[model samples]
Target: MRLSQSLIPTLKETPAEAQIASHRLMLRAGLVRQMASGIYAWLPAGLRVLNKISAIVREEQAAAGAQELLMPTIQSADLWRESGRYEAYGKEMLRITDRHERDLLYGPTNEEMITSIMRESVKSYRELPQNLYHIQWKFRDEVRPRFGVLRGREFLMKDGYGFDLDYAGALLTYKKMMLAYMRTFQRIGITAIPMRADTGQIGGDLSHEFHILAPTGESGVFYDATFEAGDPAAAADVETFYEQMTTIYAATDEKHDLAAWEKIPDERRREGRGIEVGQIFYFGKKYSESMNFTVTGHDGTKIFPEMGSYGIGVSRLAGAIIEARHDEAGIIWPDAIAPFRAAILNLRQGDAATDKICNELHEKLGADCLYDDREERAGAKFAEADLMGHPWQIIAGPRGAANGQVELKRRATGERLELSVADALAKVMS
Candidate 1:
């Protein structure tokens, strides 16, 4: 995409309302704009990042055996009532009534809706183990939404539901999801530790929240250093991986175990703040029983299938990643999830040689490259490239272009090297 033809309205000054690094940077970088108190309109650049994150999530979820199926943002109030949470959900739910006088709501979550779907479709134990997921927008009407997308009222989420014939099967499915979540976070270039967490309104005895360590996080966290020593996705045994994760001493401030903290060696102790990005709950029959979702057992008896729900804050992750990875200059986007692979900057926008080199590089890189062809100073272009957080920057100035060379700068390390255009393209593509 050419910068001159793009709609990235980057700002030199940060918005006064943005209190966090992610919020401030996102606005100044022209990724999103506030549409209302707690709502935002994602710009083209922001949407690209969001879509990349969602793709990674979908891939990991599919690898873990979940089928993809989209659910609606609005749901009938009757579904929540069947699960006995219509009144209990509180004001966060934006309850609505249509002209026909029927109650409805912008769903905060899809647990009830999914449960009702399974109840109507699955009637036998033969179809017991089923997992379905969707990536969709959800609304909660946060009373005091802040921190940009991190605490936004309307946001994109990847929520999945799993059903099994018995408790053991449900537990196995939950473990699979844990592994999937770890892989997803790792692929997105972030380290997320799974800590035991309260089920809260979700109502489950077993729950875990995945948190990314960041200085500006809302929750103070205590964890073991082993979490960073190895990759959870490398473990071949799902049960062993799950056991090791749950047994480790990891918790948010609210659930910190002082006695357990002292038990670990001083050198192995690690504590910091964490921003929650995802959560998994093995709620068993919480939804199925209340909603009367039943399946026929082998002997013809009705059984309430054990169920679990897994969730990842799709939109919030874009902000959380910035919170964890940004530097003084701007966001240091991880290569895997960057909006574009590289930015091709024409240091001398109209210079015949520089423009030719940059245009060639842009064409070679195809849609993955952001070509800065705007009539802006070299310094301004550099600043915007850094602020937008492309993984690499290909700079073509008259001097370098005349010599058939271009400077390739790695955003994460601030390393620059003047190389032949061919070599630079190869490096960026590689």
Candidate 2:
């Protein structure tokens, strides 16, 4: 993508309303623009990052045995009423009246809708232990929506539901999801600690919220040193890893227990603010029983299946990633989700020789790089490139281009080396 042809409206000064780092950086870097109070139009660059995050989530969910199938953004009020939450959901749910005066809602969550879908189609215990997921838009009319996408009224989400004939099957599904969440966060380049959390509106006996530690986080999180010690994905067994994670003392402020926290060694206790990126809940028959969804048992008795819901905030993750990975210059995007892996900067834009080298690099990198082919000053180009946070920056100056040389810069480390154009391209691709 050429900068001259792109729609990245990079700003020199921060927008006054952007109170958080992600919010401010996103605006200054031209990733998103506000459409309404908590609604945003994701610009090209922002959409790229969001799509990459969603892809990672889909891959992880599929590997964990969840199948993908999209559900609608709007749901019938009757579905919520069947689950006894139509009136209980409150103002957050955007209730609507259609032309025929039918009550509907922009779904904040899909528990009721998914329950209805599965109930109508799945009727036997043999087809139990099914996991379905979808990545789609969701809305929750927050009373005070702020902090960019962190507390947005509208956002993208990946919500998955699991159904099992019995508690044992549900427990196994829950463990698989826990392992999947750990791997997902790691692949997206964030250390998200799974902490005990209150289920709130989604009634459940067991719940865990995965949070990324950041000073600007909304939740006060407490955990033990062991939670951050090693890679959870490398564990040999999912059940063993799930046991280790659950047993460790980790909780958000609301669930923090002083007695349990003090039981840990003084050196092991740790506390910090954390941004919630995902959560998993095993609500058993909460939704199935309320919605009267049942499957025939082995002996022919009707029984409600145990169910669980797992969610990863797809759009909010962009803000969360920025919160966890940015520096003073701008966002330092994780290579796994960066809009472009590399950016080629033509320091002398109109110069024939410089253009030749940059165009060559751009051609070789293809869709994987952003080529700065603008007529802007060299310093402006450097600043904007840093702000965009591509993993690699290939600098093509007139003098260097004349010598068939270019400077390769590693964005995260700020390491720069002058090498032949071929050498720089090879290093970046590697």
Against the true structure, whose lDDT is highest? 1
The TM-score that candidate 1 achieves is 0.99
Error of 2 at 57 (Å): 0.4
| Candidate 2 lDDT for residue 111 | 95
lDDT of 2 by residue, 233-346 (tens): 698998899889889999999999999999999999999999999999999998999899999999999989999999999999999989988899998998999999999999
Q: List the residue pairs that clash in candidate 2.
A: none
Worst-scoring 10-residue span by lDDT in model 2: 226-235
Poorly placed runs, candidate 1 (over 4 Å): none
TM-score of each: 0.99, 0.98
Residue 293 lDDT (model 2)? 95
Candidates' lDDT values, in order?
Answer: 0.94, 0.92
